[model samples]
Target: MHVLVVDDEPALRQILSAAVGRGGYSVDEAAGVVEARAKLARGDVDVALCDIKMPDGSGIDLVRESRAANIDTAFIMVTAFASVETAVEALRAGAFDYIIKPVRNEEVLNRLAQIAALRGLRQENKALRRQVRERSPVYRFGSPGMLEVERLVRKVAPTTGTVLITGESGTGKGVIARLIHELSDRSERPFLSVNCAAIPEQLMESEFFGHTKGAFTGADRGRKGLLLEADGGALFLDEISELPLPMQTKLLNVIEDKGVRPVGSEQVRNVDVRIIVATNRVLPELVKEGRFREDLFFRLSMFQIEIPPLRERQADMRGLIRFLLLVHGNRNGTALDIDPEAEEVLLAYRWPGNVRELENVIQRACILAEDNYITVADLPSAIAAATSPRPVAGTSADAKSHLRDRLRNFEADILASAIEEAGGDRKLAAQALGISLSSLYRKLDEMGHA
Candidate 1:
């Protein structure tokens, strides 16, 4: 990291320069704000450790000037004269942080390390998006349920409304999202996706709206948030129900105004993009519990699409399996054949993890196949054990029990499999089973597993 030290005091300059230099940073020394601005123009500086008391101008003034010119340098003010008012003013003028003089060199070094991590994350995000743009994914679905979904995608592709996709997890929510983007007029533009459940809640808002250099902790430079990066394109926010209530409001405002305001900055940038959001859980139930904002939910679901679970649409399973066979077959550099018995087992089992689990199983079977033929034993133990359920000694379940009782027992089996598939995460199991946590708990207790 290149750290610039701008202090008018010769003694302080020598001390900070040597200490920070030895701390493994490329250090540049500037006597005043004027020299600091000149060094900043060189554009090699990652952070500027500037003193408030400078000969030419206050460090705050330099911060304002550098930011106004878009220098992209993180600024930290170091001053012996520190006050609540001064600190607030420095931050308002866009300094990343303030340190009271009698300064601990350790604090300075720690702050620099944080700035380095932020820069690293920024570069990583950029590289990931670039990689996505270089090559995109293609999804083909032959089931009637998915064909209906494809029709809906075609119908909505020309419109400007927000799309809300609801389904069980791993039912190809991401695939539907990508299809919506690829069929739209913005097909040639950037397509960015953010998994809300995967990101830390504290950083969620900033990741969506972006932030300027020195806007907040560790914000070493400016960044274009996902919404802006998808300008003139599509931004697919998967697991949208996982978004915090506060962020849901912000996202609603962006959808309403077609703009985004970066964190800690007054400027609101207009963006022309389509918003496609997906969630495995039901949003209305969350709103009823006061966990999600109702207004935002209404706005986002303007064009709603509901996807059926894999078991509910078994007709599509064969086509999907064939597609997977081709993909994993090519990946392993061999032609894979599935015997009749293995195919029967696959069709009989309830896929709690949906298509994703199917892909994983296929990949594993491809690796384990002998003579390019996948056998029943090659399947995951959980799936391989579920070959086919036999009736209780020729007794008809319907003849012996009430319809509701039979369904209750049937649902119990599904819950058990989903729980095992999720490795005992009740939350994930609930998502896989298309039920709420409370519902899952109640069912588990009813089944004598509590």
Candidate 2:
């Protein structure tokens, strides 16, 4: 932890700094509010210990300024005044804790620990808020397949092994990668992501390793590579299969050596980086076909997670659609409702493009929809095309069979609509459907949709 000590008294500042440093934290000193503000502007201070009365300004003012700037640094006010009124005022002004002057070393350490815990709580709360805001009811799934996948993610996320996530396009691989990072110890560090398929092959190396000034025609200043930028953090290599063979070798070397040598620089810089790779390709086949290196595949696949396709988890469809409706509605600042008949048709249709396709359909439906609720007519031509086929008419036994088949189709259509709206992930789809993963899976199997 980095600590800033702010006090007007030279002796007090030095004594407190030494004590803080001894407590396994780096210390920066500021004699007054002006110096403190300058130090804060540089953006490295994590916790600030300030005197209530400074020569230039009050510590309360500094706390208020820090809060106004949206800095996450924790503040503690140290002063001769220890009255309840003074403490309350400081707390209201954003001081994390109030400490009396002539401070004991043990007391200071205890208060610092409390501040650290509070900071952690605040960070967790922020993360939870972001999750809630970004989340829609659409990703819920009650299938056994989804439960197993969740269990695997929980097991593998905390390990040091490299993870390779594979799935069909738009199957929420990116979300899974983020969940792994969020669950890991490196959650506090930077989580850098690069889509290999998006960047041109020529610029791939430079983008990953960075380039020193004068290294290339356009090079003006030394640039820190993304690998270096993600030092002591995670580097998410999305669509890793898109990388050319030559660049793959270099990336493999970096992963193995735990360092990188920037372009035009002979000096090697060590890095502490965790890699999480995602791809939509069949990597084993690619390796056999000689398109990908077998060694590199082994290095990346220390832990492999294969996300099931939407069709395989059809029971999650209904919840997914509702989730998507809410998401699109919230994003567009409009309210949308889905008719049961339209939703049933949605569940019956197969989502060839997976979750991405579902989101596109919902967005389209929302824009075209004239009423509060979305009807079958509001759905896209492609979705209607896939869902309009009818069963043949027959006799008594056949009639019972046909009726059962029709009911199953209706259920499938509802599930598909939910999944589409939820954005194709089972967990969110299940939540939107208000069912468990096991029940969703059972429904899918019964309908021959899984």
TM per candidate: 0.60, 0.59
> 16-59, model 1: which lDDT tens digit per residue?
88888877676778999888877676444668999997779899
Best by lDDT: 1
The alpha-carbon root-mean-square deviation between model 2 and the true structure, to one decimal in Å, is 13.4
Instruction: Give, for candidate 1, the lowest lDDT window spanning 10 residues.
Output: 399-408
**Residue-by-residue lDDT tens digits, candidate 2, 1-450:** 457899999999999999987886667789999998876654445689999988799999899998887665788899998789888989998888888989888888888878756655654565456556664333656767676778888898888679999999998887888778778888876567789999988777778887655677876545657786666567889999988999989988998987677676554556677899999999999999999999999999988999898878776787788888887855356679987767876777778788888888888878655546675646765576577444557655554443235555667898999888988887788788776676577567655777
After superposition, which runs of candidate 1 have C-alpha atoms over 4 Å from their true positions?
1-139, 331-333, 390-450
TM-score of 1: 0.60
lDDT per model vs. reference = 0.79, 0.78
* Top-TM-score candidate index: 1
Error of 2 at 30 (Å): 30
lDDT of 2: 0.78
